[model samples]
Target: MDFGEFVMARTPALLRFAYLLTGDSHLAEDLIQEALVRVHRRWSSIEYQGGPEPYVRKAILNQYLSWRRRRSSAELVLAELPERRDPALGAEQIVERDEMWSLLATLPRAQRAVVVLRYYEDLADQDIALLLDCSPATVRVHAFKALKRLRAALTPTAVAGASHGRA
Candidate 1:
């Protein structure tokens, strides 16, 4: 497919993946723009590899990883706290989603990427390993650690209850 056709077909999915990786819509847009630019420049070569989507995704992931590394290296101080959430926006599902995202944000980058790829992208461990340039065991370990952390954070009451029962 042509570059434009590929972009039209893939942009939405790419944006969603980027957003999941970055947890920010604006950052996701920036990531997609940077990735697409690189992909466009190498479109012929990427297409020769049989598909551009994976190549674009890898570019986006690399860009995100690089951007995050740079961002973390710079220290910034906030003068004040941000505003509170709107009470009118108190849908249970939205709150749950926000909580989940907040929990996911606590994970290390590789673990977060592994979780997003395995669950959100529904990719197999082997595929994620290939994409991340790691072994399948490494991917599994990341996923295992991420899920363990999520479970502990999400269900502290259950864990507490189990501890009480054991006592």
Candidate 2:
């Protein structure tokens, strides 16, 4: 397939992953857009890399980091807003998701990125290790710590949600 086709096919997944990483839908969109532009510019080079997705993902992460660095301390709190809510879900479900995201946000950047990439993106630990340019053992450590923090934040009902396959 061509570059446009590849990008079109991957955009939704990239957006979801970006949203999970940055938490704000609009900012995620902006991040993805900028990253995609850069990817498109280097498409010939990236197309031979086996998995351009990781390159794009790393670009998005770097974009977020740059954004954070440029932001004032006062803006940091707001810039890290939770993912946008779905109007379809019930209030309780919405609140639960928000709480979960909030807890995820509390993690150190590397840990949070690993958790989202592993659990939400369903990537193998080795893939995440490659994406983050870390060892598989380090990815495991980050995932472990992130899960611990999430588990600590969960209420009984939220824990039950996981058992019910709702989380």
Output the number of the TM-score-best candidate. 1
Please give each candidate's TM-score: 0.77, 0.72
lDDT agreement of model 1 with the native: 0.80
Task: Write candidate 1's Cα lDDT for 1-167 as tens digits.
Answer: 99888777777788789889988876666777777777888787654455777778888877876664322232212232223357777599778989999999999889999999999999999889878889999999999999999998999998888889995
Candidate 1 stretches greater than 4 Å from native: 47-50, 68-90, 157-167
lDDT of 2 by residue, 39-112 (tens): 78888866546667667787787776555433222211132334455789999997888888888878988888
lDDT of each: 0.80, 0.74
Model 2 superposed RMSD (Cα): 8.4
lDDT of 2: 0.74
Model 2 misplaced regions, further than 4 Å: 47-51, 65-88, 155-167
